[model samples]
Target chain A: MTAVRPFRPRSGFHADQRAGRLFAAYLVSLLLHGLLLFALAGGWPGHAARSDKPPVYYVDLVHKPVLDPQAGRPEPRTPDTPVPAPPEKAPVRAAVPAGPAAAGSTDRRVAAALEKLRDERALQEKFAAMRQAQAVPKETPVGLSDARGTEAGVGTLAYVQAAIQQNWALSPYLLADPRKAAGVEAWVRVTYSRNGRLERFSFEMESKDAQFNESIKRALVKSQQLPQPLPERLEEVRVVFNLKAMKDLAGLR
Target chain B: MELITNAGLVVKLVLLILAYFSVTSWAIIIYKTLVIQRATRDSARFLDFFWARRRFDVIAQGLDDFRHSPLAVLFRDVHQELLQNRRAADGGGEGLDADLGEQDRVARVLRRATTSETHRLEKYLAFLATTGSAAPFIGLFGTVWGIMDAFHGIGKSGSASLAVVAPGISEALVATAIGLVAAIPAVIAYNHFVNKVNVLIGEMDNFCQEMLNVVQRLPRSRQER
Candidate 1:
């Protein structure tokens, strides 16, 4: 409680400065926010429309190795003793590579060189059959590049594969990831009568990818029935889903 | 598709709230800056004008320019009190301006004026403090909620991949980022405005004492013409 206090004066500028400054700042912030929104909407990276990249799928046909059934017990070498053997006489490969060696591998690099030649003489005989078959109404088999090269067990395989290829539709979800899609390997064994009426079907090989696996199943189901009548000798057809052929059918890549 | 539309409802709501906080906080900052700046400038001018001339009539006549300054309000109140006290004292012809009680009364009047002016300067500062401290936490809550929803989506979708969860997480994080955006400036402005208010309050207090000192030396009563 001091007795008397001295008297002085001060400026009044701070009295209500907050209100005006706050109003202005609020306005400025809103304006700036609006401008930012406009900029974002206008695609500020030079105003180009932000078009989504269509996921490109480079479909590669992976040919599973055709295991030599003549494996484990090597046939007695016909006196062509193994050493750095002459390239002209390399053993057991270029034979009836399926017997017909149908598509004489138009692009050698794309053809996985798993073919072993027994002798050029045998290759000449199969090549003649392959050329004759190609001259007929040609049908490309789905799983393996050329089914005519096989012995006599692929007419129904060819028909079923063509049917599934025609029916398989790639889902857009699967289209987002082609790498994942390619790994989806599933096999369906269809039991059919000689008249080609499908009696039953079950997955023989199920790849873990559910969506891609489902697409393969859906394709077979969509086909419903094969195009041509099956031979009486063929009671069932086990078809390995060729995703590459499916991609070709779906026109995805 | 725009990422925001894909964001879960909780995240969207949180973003909306953060946006509101940002807009409001900016408003406060802008308003506070303008007010404090004007107050400082005009109040300083008023104080300088006051000290140079040391005249009630001259400065009081020009209180309009310093309307936002706490000091002006202080000066006006004190000046009015002093004039009233002086008029009362003149009729009594007591101990003049040197009278201890009269001096004490003027000091009391000044103390009161300073208290009220200081009060005025402190207005809206609590709002600033609240925004500065709470906004970030509010934003964090939104982020947490958004992440929770995102994880829930993954659980429902049965996909634990990054692509599945990334968009949701990004959307949720936006709330936290915006919260910080709103809070940072609010905190800066609040501290600054508080400091300015304190300086203005100090000036008003100094002014009260100076006003008393000047009045103490004045003649107790006007002589007969």
Candidate 2:
């Protein structure tokens, strides 16, 4: 072959070289941007792969004291149920008569006496009834617990108990948060027959966290028979307890 | 593995193919845009240089510098024809009556040059048209296959729950989305490139007529020489 000649740059060669470099840089930058986009959105598929759960809320029910009917009677009130002072009371009126002064006065006094006696008798009867009602057996019903008992059905309680026993078998990630442990509370309400066997058992209220509520619901569901049957005549029963003990027992904590 | 084994797999495969097509089409679009833009700029520059120069010899030298350009090629062909006619007239060897024949020869040469220039300008455009027209259908085919797979899965699973059906349908729909992704840009690029090519062709036609007019106006002896 002939000897190689030294090369010289042609006109526009530098412009062509610059254009090529710019094009290459553009391509490289586009590639890097696409990769960055992919990196950012790539986790979405995995996130979507996870299962969905429901939300839970706190609820409770408490019994109020019965009111005394006789306390409001229009009579000489006792210290426990005293009448208000004049500033707090409505205006009063004087009596009218239809006979001679002596006879009318006597008759008005008798009517007042009878009215007072009637009011006293009514108050005594109300107190006696309230006393009798209070005398009734006040026992917690079997399979009955706190506010959760009203919210959840008997089947839901059994389900919760079973789930708790199974260590919340649905997913390991369900109770991974420690905050959820404190939130998991069980409310059991029981309506017992005279023999104390569970007539109706329910999970009244659940934890605000969905996973915790589901676990509680599952636990109650699994424990069909209560530890002991309730006594007869206990019409209703309720119990509210945090789920931390149950979770610890189940080794889920 | 057969593509039709499951509709979902088929759909995913189709989407993947469509993605490939989209990527390739975008690359082509970018490349073609750059090429067409450069052609337009360079051709405009060459035309301006050709017209601005008063001397035919200077214009011819400039055309030589842009020998790679379609417009330059057209100009060179016209200039050659004009030079041949001038040479023949300067020689005065044969019929002064043959001036009409020389003009006809020049016209033929110009027509041939126009055809060549047009062909060069239209190069690779057919591929772009084909891509634009067919990409959408390809993507749709993928989507249809995917949906069929999703239904088949639902039938096999024996459950028509939203949880089960939604995921499968969503996955299958990805194919159709990819198809649209591939097709939209291709169609847009095709239209844009076609319009550009048409404009360039119009310019070429106008330039050819203008060159012809200038050639025809030359002094007979000067043109021949």
Candidate 3:
């Protein structure tokens, strides 16, 4: 090989610069990695995308429509023919004394007008009774706990009823009480926490029979913890317990 | 932090491995960036110096400043080969035949130098490729192990509620996120550096051919003459 010639001292300088740069870059990279780990360890509060709100559950308490479809249907109109004068016309006659032919005709017209007004009032009363019949059935004595919260559905209400009924102890002797059996009904209001703990309770409407009311109180006490936790929004329920209705619900004679 | 701190031991191990991969690969990316950029800049400037100066001795003396340039290395190697051939021809009193042989020897030297320069440019790039390909799977391994632990927890607790399972799953998923974090930059840097190296290789090859032509025309080394 030809003798190697020594060049100016630029190579060492270049190599030294490169080494310095590489070292600096390594340090920067280490600092960046440290920052990343620090940020991760800090948890970056509120940056999490997950929602914290509890899922809301909706329950349909009343499966059937509250208003009857037939109640809203227009009533059939009666023909406008003049109504015949019946014994009820005595009041109209008493108002009109003996008069000339023209005066008598006007009095007859007045009596007819009064008769039409009475018929219209009777029709309105009949419609009112029909509407009332179509309204929601009143509290059943079988203790279908009324869940007033919007979130409580038919299933939840049924669950509450079943849980309470499972712990209820209705004595056969109380049902056999001849004088008070039919009249033994009590309304109890119960409130619960999210964890199924019974928070508070009171007798909203108590029965006159002390024994029957005591039995209702005992059932509530026994069912202190519901089988399932109450829905978040459902906290209070009003339960009506009637001895006769309970007997009927249980298929007991 | 709780997500990582509360993670299972296996997942934490995986995260640690990924962190290693990420930090090292980033360092490699930085070092390579500086190296490739210097090589490219110096190579272009060396080409300018080579064309401007006609004397081989001047070019050889200037090679030190362009030491990072692959073209400069190729020129230096071929120039040394030409010098050796010139000495052999002058000492042996063989001119015509030795000149032809000298061209062949110089060509061989050019090829070897091109190969060496390419190797230098491509150094340290394999680690980036390895990090890109392996990190994600390693992270996935951690995630699978975490989920297994979570299910095991459920079996022991006898509870399958979201509250019981969610925290475990969240912690497990963190491994996957970290794996992706480690892999993405490595993959990007690997691709970028590969392209840069390829461009340098092409320049070196072209310079090798150009240097061979110049050596052929010289017929003999100027220093020997």
Top-TM-score candidate index: 3
Winner on lDDT (2 vs 3): 3
Instruction: Pick the winner on DockQ between candidates 1 and 2.
Output: 1
The TM-scores, one per candidate, come to 0.50, 0.48, 0.53
Model 1 reproduced share of reference interface contacts? 0.51
Chain A only: list TM-scores of all candidates. Answer: 0.39, 0.27, 0.38
Report how closely model 2 matches the true complex, as a DockQ value: 0.02
For candidate 2, what is the DockQ-based docking class? incorrect
Task: Specify the poorest-scoring 10-residue window by lDDT in model 3 chain B.
Answer: B90-99
Residue pairs in steric clash, candidate 3? A59-A153, A60-A154, A61-A154
**Residue by residue across A39-109, what tens digits does model 3's lDDT show?**
66654555444445568996534332221122222223334422333333334444545567678788778
Looking at model 3, residue A225 earns an lDDT score of 83
Which run of 10 residues does model 3 chain A get worst, by summed lDDT?
Answer: A64-73
Chain A of candidate 3 gets a TM-score of 0.38
List the lowest-lDDT window of 10 residues for candidate 2 chain B: B1-10
How do the candidates score on chain B by TM-score?
A: 0.85, 0.80, 0.92
lDDT of 2 by residue, A83-126 (tens): 32223222234545456857877777868876876776677667
Flag regions of model 2 displaced more than 4 Å: A1-107, A113-253, B1-9, B63-69, B80-109, B220-225
